[model samples]
Target: MENLPKSIQVIFDKNPKLSELITNPRLISNSPFIFALSQKLNYSAKGNEDEYFYRIVFKEGSSRELMTINSGELRGLPTTTCIEKGKISDVAGLERVELDNESNLMPVLLGISLYSSIQNSLSYISNLCVDIRNHQILEGQARFERISETIVDIFNSIPDLALDKSLRDAYLSRIVKNNDDCYELYVSQREQLRHSLKGNNPDYNSKYYYENELYLFKDKLLTHPVFSVFERLVAGRICEIILSGNYSKSNIQRHKDFISKAESDINDIMASRISDLDRRISYYKRDIEMDRNLTRDGIEYHNTQIEKIELGISSIKKQIFNLLGVKLSSFDLLSQLMSKDEIDVFLIGGNLIVNDMQLTSDEML
Candidate 1:
């Protein structure tokens, strides 16, 4: 309290509750005239912790009433706001003023209220993670349903934090990475299971049971809800950020570079996946042809396995298409010039047509 500026100390002296509630406050902004003060708070609920970020903007002189501005405006600003005296204020207005005797303290109070709201939203997400993990203990369709619900809950929570673009992007990137890691882990486990099953006797009942297990595992892996959800969330966020029209030329260029790199990475990953799927299909086809005593069901199982592998290859191809679409949509002119069908053909044949000229995917990206 003693380290605070005279003006700030005066405000706290006048409003005793300000010092009591604003825990771990740090002076984030200061000027010769002390126009604003920002603080980052650590808020916790139900044993889950989240950051509560807020700022306060002071009026030029004395005898000024409290005012509110949209959270979007708060970005790049020196100060943030909170509520005062148990009153809740809207955090969405561009600029709205309200008369109050303690106008100097109102901005700080508003900042606190905003932080509390953000913390609550984060706590809700933490709860959802816990719920999903518990549900994963269940088997089969029930587990898949629970996981889908949790992902939806996360998507819904995203809009609540839209005001803080950096925070929202960070949270989303973390989720995507975690889900990708989980998908890889699941695939590895399935492969290990497949190898183990191959060591079993090729009797009719045993062969049928092994095939059934592999089919179920492969179906679940290929159709995992997280895969499509990941594509939508990632691509949607990338497009939103690029199209927001808020960034400088240099920042926009940086985003473009990122999109290009992502396209390259996706292409590499898709190629590797397609190759692996093709190898598996070949192996299954060979098993059907070479096994002299293979029953009708055994032959049918191998054929089904080949079909599933082909479907997986198609899914990987679609993923690349989605990523390339995102990259193209980032450019207004390119997006307008190319239709989805044109993009699909471009991806399929590695060639794109624009204004009577054909361009390779590499050149386009």
Candidate 2:
């Protein structure tokens, strides 16, 4: 659970099967559980606050005990306690007395637990989005457009949970500063492709050359450090927003154009699919009538083709259902953007005296 992102943990805690799939890179899709978890975060965050608590376990013989306090009415209550002994694994050139006096271990472990959860959450969301766009069944730019729109919408719905502007900008600024060369190359390749496309007799070789270069550019974009940094930033922002309830209009609007483009592209795909289905339906019906007395094999082949057409229609319907809801501006469509409702934030007081910070629902947003 410590290794998994909070978003993934949310799903894992509810459905154990999903936990198995977490480390299995081959099976991560926008599965029903993922979608459901996403919805819960989006909608639940809007109403109630999420409760936060920290737990720590210490090793003792073959088992572990919850750390606890020793005084007052809550004397028996679990508390942050000290480690009394070290394992055989800690015997490397270390004095026995030194092992028990490792006072810095607690904060080091706490910091790891905190940042690891955050970084993992960002990786989970970004990887999921990329995987969805790269599904084998999709073969064009429409998938990118659709997923881009989905990302924008999801980010927009979450309350602005970004930290101070300087911190947020620091992550974002890295994108431009670190990737100037790649950005220039990408722009040059795009311009080259545009020029090639506008030519009267652009050779197949030239077209392929430009296309391949553009594909490489995209690969570079995905692998770039800045891309991962931005994803972590977005994930952290969303987590904070859901927990805090603060809304950042600027953050929400960052990818508005991308969303608009995706919506347009998806709409175009819907229209094209509908048109193709109508044409194929008419053609197949006429062919069946004209060959009314054909051999059994010929008739079977026609029937098979018709069945495939029917399947295509069914697939488009499902895609439409997933990508765009029954009506525009409906909450159901917001499911596409999801990935929460709320709880609370806390720092359990003990040896660690960080008091629980009180915040209202609005302040959280």
Off by over 4 Å in 1: 1-83, 86-257, 270-274, 288-297, 319-328, 332-365
Could you give the C-alpha RMSD of every candidate to the true structure, in order shown? Answer: 20.3, 17.1
Candidate 2: segments with Cα more than 4 A from true spot: 1-123, 126-164, 172-260, 266-278, 290-298, 316-342, 349-365
Taking all chains together, the TM-score of candidate 1 against the true structure is: 0.30
lDDT (CA) per prediction: 0.41, 0.36
What lDDT score is found at residue 241 in candidate 2? Answer: 32
Worst 10 residues of 1 by lDDT: 344-353
- What does candidate 1's lDDT look like per residue over 1-365, in tens digits? 56555665676678787555543233322321122111111112244334232333444442223444547946444223334453533232223212122234333333222222323222333344444443332224353444345444544444233334444456566555544544443344344434443453233344454355345434543343333333333333332332232234454455556555544544553354356457666777887889889999989978887776577567656655653554344443233223323211100011111112233465345
lDDT of 2 by residue, 1-365 (tens): 45434554555578787445343221122332223333434445587435322223334442233345679899887544443343222111211111111243233222222322333223354453455434322223343334334444333322111221332334344332323333333334334333433342323244253334334334432232323223323333333333232234443343333233433434453454355455655666687789667777877876776686576567656645433332222211122122123212211111111111223455323
- How does model 2 fare in lDDT? 0.36
Clashes of 2: 27
Alpha carbon lDDT of residue 104, candidate 1?
A: 40
TM-score: model 2 vs. ground truth? 0.32
